[model samples]
Target: MRPPVRLALAAAAASALQIPLQPPNGANVQPVLVESDALADRVGAGNLQKRAEALYEIAELSVDEYGHPTRVIGSRGHLGTINYIKSTLDGLGGYYNLSDQIFSAVSGSVYQAKLVIGDVVPSFTTMGLTPATENKEPVHGDLVLVGDLGCKSSDYPDTAMGSILLIRRGECSFGQKSELAGQAGAVAAVVVNSEQDEIHGTLGAPSPNHVATFGLSGATGGGFIEKLESGEVLDAIAYMDADVDIIETMNIVAQTTHGDPDNCVMLGGHSDSVTEGPGINDDGSGSLSVLEVAVQLSHYKVNNCVRFGWWSGEEEGLLGSNYYVASLSEEENAKLRLFMDYDMMASPNFAYQVYDATDAANPVGSEKLRDLYTAWYEDHGLNYSLIPFDGRSDYDGFIRHGIPAGGIATGAEGVKTEAEEDMFGGRAGEWYDPCYHQLCDDLHNVNLTAWEVNTKASTFALSPFALSTTRSTANAGWV
Candidate 1:
């Protein structure tokens, strides 16, 4: 530690003008999660204005970074999105020196094509669905309508044989969709966007014998319907390319082993995304936000061993994180204080959300993020919501290990509810991020408020628990 004068100079320069270095009580500091008056007083008007500006730039960069074709596990259109993430952390310049952990999502290849009004090349967006390079054959058939062909919804007449079945995307995993399509007698499936605002027209799953999968924009579909009404040919072609092997992807990790070795605190976020989209907000925001925090804190010699992880193969399933947890020795895992995963922290239009787990009835994670978020929102006077933890995040790994894990996510794949609209003030029935998995999910599409809520909420709650993780590890020994 430096001398009193040097420390004072360092604090003055390092602390955000709004936030002082030490607590009003001096050495005994209050955690930001508590929203103490001291904190509120420090974060005055000018300081907030500066913070908001910094936040906006970060959000823009995150969104910009996410959709830049960074596909881990390498698929069609998945460029160097992963590389950018790695580089960003490296460029952030710190000792949290990045490391990579590779894993596989393990899915079959898929191919897709489309046929709209002939002599007219129908407008389309070729999403992740790659046309099967190995198995391509010409087949023509009447379009069949298959509603929600989830893995369990064995309701659609088998459409995998020869006919073209029209299936809408919903309620099931992409892998499940491929399986369902294979079981059906249809040669290929044309999966149209379930919503009018869908950025991509078709969604194809990886599968064997999956012929051609195709997409038509909502507008194109409406026009096709008009053509059908007028007795015109609404013919189209689709193919599901299923010839690729399971591609292994890499995740970056950097460890700051401090605090108590027995108790560990983990910080992480996914570094991959859908084929067409850059995945910035879907995760870029959280990635950068967490990365920034990690870089800043890495300089400090803290208590409790801390690990920073960047997950891969999250777009397909929670695979990378799951594997890491599985690999840890039972004893090595015992000291886990908590896991805090930040996912999609910068939704351009996200409403502040919290994982509503361990309620008054049950307490989860370090201390249920509920109160932390509630206080943060109230102190800021922002709209807030608490949603259940449904294993939708990377924390799924910690949960599987019976470790109390908590996480923060600004928005993703699902649409917002009506009540949510009333609170956020966006279009009435649209999803929080329409550009979620599209190439359009670029840096330009970040909501300022959403970014702040996620970053601040996570930092405020996580830092204290992280610093004190050893307590949890100690308690775990008794359990």
Candidate 2:
């Protein structure tokens, strides 16, 4: 789902600016010495807040006529955001080596979606990347229930041919269910949520084998199931008009010009957003934090190479980071001392959550990375919690490659528990970011306290590593 962004500037401009028009190899760098605390002191809360507000303004200007302030990958908004970051780095006067890693991916959005069950028009959200209805018109068919969760091919009935398949959500991804429904000859697939509300999802990627897939609310879908159980045969109409295209985008990677390339410290945040809103809080917080740190670090020097990445296609499925990691050779991978990720650093109702790398999925030096954040928070008199090191963000790509990885998150759609409320002073029983992935995730979506604290914490944690990985006890053969 994560793809590339369009390069706003021409190759001539890049050449004129002395920017690396190609992907970076952390070459021609010089290392300087810097203290962790001194660098941390430069990451002012006011500075971060200022940049965040500017980001929101940029997002607003990028809004389409449809009223969506979307910085979704390959969109004009996203390209503008990338240009902003690149320009910021360029203004830093070549203190870092900058490069754009370009790649192609299918970006999609639903322009229109409609579902009518018999005489009733029910609410629905179209799954991204699902094929449009034939001619983008409503396809009328009998709604046939595909028994079970519709994970297996056998779960679909032969009667589903040319009909819309009503499948329950569970046991598999929406894409898997849609693919199976297509193979069974269903014209469209409606995946009903097992949970309460209507859901928004993706087919994961562009698929020729997918029909128009839509998600219906649990109440609406359950009502249909009950009517069917009562011997009612339903005729349904499904329509979807979507825009799906394979577009080229770029990942911005910058490393300190003077550092030990053989042993480097890296950090990253996704630069793209979902189709719904500007994603100011969801990631603008994180991306700007990295940018701020990278900018501030230009004032100092580092012993070990320090690289910052503003990844694209993360919202799609960590595509940018995955591609970047896969592009690395084994020796290059080994040269990476560790990677720290900053994702939603400023959720409205935030929790100071660090990546818990105790799980087997964690690489050799992950625990050390986790401890660094933990210690940093404690030292700052802030409460902290541990989130699983799952492949939910860009860190997954590096962790899977046996590189030590850790990061912080300010919670997403997940609800804030009473314990978290007690620790972070946010309301319990509410999502950490209520506006997450919505059109309202704009300038007001951030908790300034969470934004400031997390940004400072990130600076504290990364500064030491930038100096040298040997400062930590968990070195464990990391070269």
Candidate 3:
């Protein structure tokens, strides 16, 4: 069993004072319902900001001795975050059936990754699930330039055997490239970035067929390509020091005790950050928005059950939510009426992007969820665009089970287009969140206007469902 987390008095005080709790409407009496506007009015931007600021402080205090402001799964920063959330829920004083859903996940870290070609040593990032070098020693091999991206088995040359294969990123996943390289008897694989910047990504998941793989910057890769084109033999060394271990983490699932448990409305956001930063904007904005709404809703009564989940290990690929969904019994799964995800709600270069479940990857009832947010934005006189339900966030697991899922994201990583800029009023060329997954994703990374608007929009969509499932035809298409 995992150890219990202690509640902080400060968090308890904050929760109690931030919003007034209403007297419990007995389960026997027909529950009173609040309108979307009224519920949204109670969600304060200042309160959300306060929670975010506190989370930043917690993240700083929980950093490792090396001073990385991370709240990654199994890290102290994440533990602090979990405690704060649990304490806040506890302060709500029996309003919710709070649970600490515990699960184990593999946590990984790369201490160093470097690519040496003769006299030149260039920086590189290790791909996820890459095995560590023996005693931190470099792996030396003759560099063989594999024509094409090395995504296909035919792309690997005979020279790639007993040497390090150089492949470019694109056409397929890193795992596929690495697997292909290993199959070709390559000692190691170096996936050069197709873009200008260095590639910082994962190999999706662990595969025994994968050899050691590293992602290289385009400039460094281009220099090697030039050498190869000039018919120069390039002896290379790929060095990496990394470790992966199973770590225990918890997800907070809080449900109101006053409504019909058979028909449940679910909303959530990730509560953990990448190893590089505090992640105030990436998910702190979304998590806190849901938290603030949960707190405020304690003052009202709901006809249907409302569950708010604060998921951990999202930065590591939605581990917490996936485990939760996978662990659910058939009956429990049936009770979930709909799920709404709020992730990265306050990107600096924000767009009012609602999940486009109407198109590809659409789960049953997802279209209705999409229309709900679309209508809300239209009613509020706000511009909104459609973001594909790409299975990129915590919603993926829910959708995979054929559950109705929809949500909003301001933006992340993807560059803002001219059309998006004109619609949302931000610089077109820059990324939606420039500090995304970097050390700079601290407290100031959030756009307060975007945060507040998205938060209110989330409340507006959720309030109607809380009253009753009559507004949502989510069950019509459920298999």
Candidate 4:
């Protein structure tokens, strides 16, 4: 535990008063209250752009067989990302305590997944967590269309036996469809996108009960269905090759050296990306923003401990975050006053949205956090919206354990509305970020203005807590 408070001018008086005496700088001087506006003013577009460009260049360190650059877990690009963050923090002259949290997690990659019907090879991609076909060889079967959405066991007919099942993507998860089909004697599962575009998704997690699951564009899958409805026998062959194994990766945890360790404020963002792209806007924006804030924050002093987490394995699942939280001791968990998550801060078509903290499920003081973000936007004359307090990002682990959690996000795959367009001046009926998970999500994908604004908002919300956690008075003071 930290030594009891001491007054600088009264070493003799403090001893006479029975207060503990400690290091010259320890508890002797009045703690500085970090103001939102002043600290937030330090965040700018120029610096963020430099960080974004640096991350993009780091991503180039790892290229897949298809020549696409990525920072997926266990890859060179991701390792470079980890190293860059560590070296930057170390350069802070020991202002923060850094810990490299290493752990083993399941990682999967699909190199080849092809579906052929008759003489045509349809365009397809394998879903995450999908298994390789038996013997890593081709499996030929008759194409059989499953009824409805194919989420139910009865959706797979007896005719589906020894055949490849064609299922539509909707109303259920890909893993559930694959599991139901495999139980009905289907050799493989082809899930067609509900939309016109090609589907890119995960089965959510690995399961031996799942068959080789592949995603196809709605148009291509519809063509096959029409042929099947006409009572035509379509012969099909599916070849899928994937590597799923346990790999060692890490989460970077850093905390301020000065402050009450028992009272902490935490901020985090995922550090890894999907295999498809460099993932600049998806999370590189958030990760770098947090890193930049931590760097700038070192210039000031804090009362409550401030911790930053750069989580891995978020793209595959909330693996890193979940693991970290579960490993925390009960006492450690109690030290965390609140948790904030930052993600996709630079969506090309952006809307300033804060997490709704008034939700019945959210813990107390969450509304205060929500107020901080909305207040930041309002104080700056910037309009904002409220997104569901859903566990979609790295905030999942914290909120599950009843910790008050809140943050802001520009957006991701969700579509923008006309109202949002008016406020943000972007096209309606379009994704907040069109290149969200695609290879096009490079340095060119981020909107520097949106990134800077959101980063400042995050800074504003985090600064006050650094001065004094709502649960503690050790560092309480006005700026």
Winner by TM-score? 2
Model 4 Cα displacement at 321 (Å)? 0.5
Q: What is the Cα-based lDDT of residue 14 in candidate 2?
A: 30
For model 4, give the RMSD to the true fold: 10.8
| lDDT per residue as tens, model 2, 54-113 | 666556544543366778886666776787788788777778889989998778777778
Cα lDDT for residue 396, model 2? 90
RMSD of model 2 against the true structure:
4.7
Off by over 4 Å in 3: 1-32, 117-124, 147-149, 183-187, 194-198, 217-233, 359-361, 471-479
> How do the residues 26-123 of candidate 1 rate in per-residue lDDT, one tens digit apiece?
12222332222322233232322343333333223323323344333453222243444444455444534457665555433333444544455666
Global lDDT of each model?
0.55, 0.81, 0.79, 0.81
Kindly list the per-residue Cα lDDT of model 4 for residues 343-432, writing each as its tens digit: 899999899989997646676667788998998888889999999987778888987876778899998877789999889889898889
How does residue 158 of candidate 1 score in lDDT? Answer: 55
Q: Kindly indicate the candidate among 1 and 4 with the higher TM-score.
A: 4
Which 10 consecutive residues of model 2 have the lowest summed lDDT? Answer: 18-27
TM-scores of all models? 0.70, 0.88, 0.86, 0.86
Candidate 3 Cα lDDT to native:
0.79
lDDT of 3 by residue, 418-438 (tens): 998888999998889989888
Per-candidate Cα RMSD to the true structure, in Å, reads: 10.2, 4.7, 4.7, 10.8
Alpha-carbon runs more than 4 Å astray in model 1:
1-99, 104-112, 115-134, 146-160, 168-172, 191-236, 239-245, 359-363, 416-418, 469-479
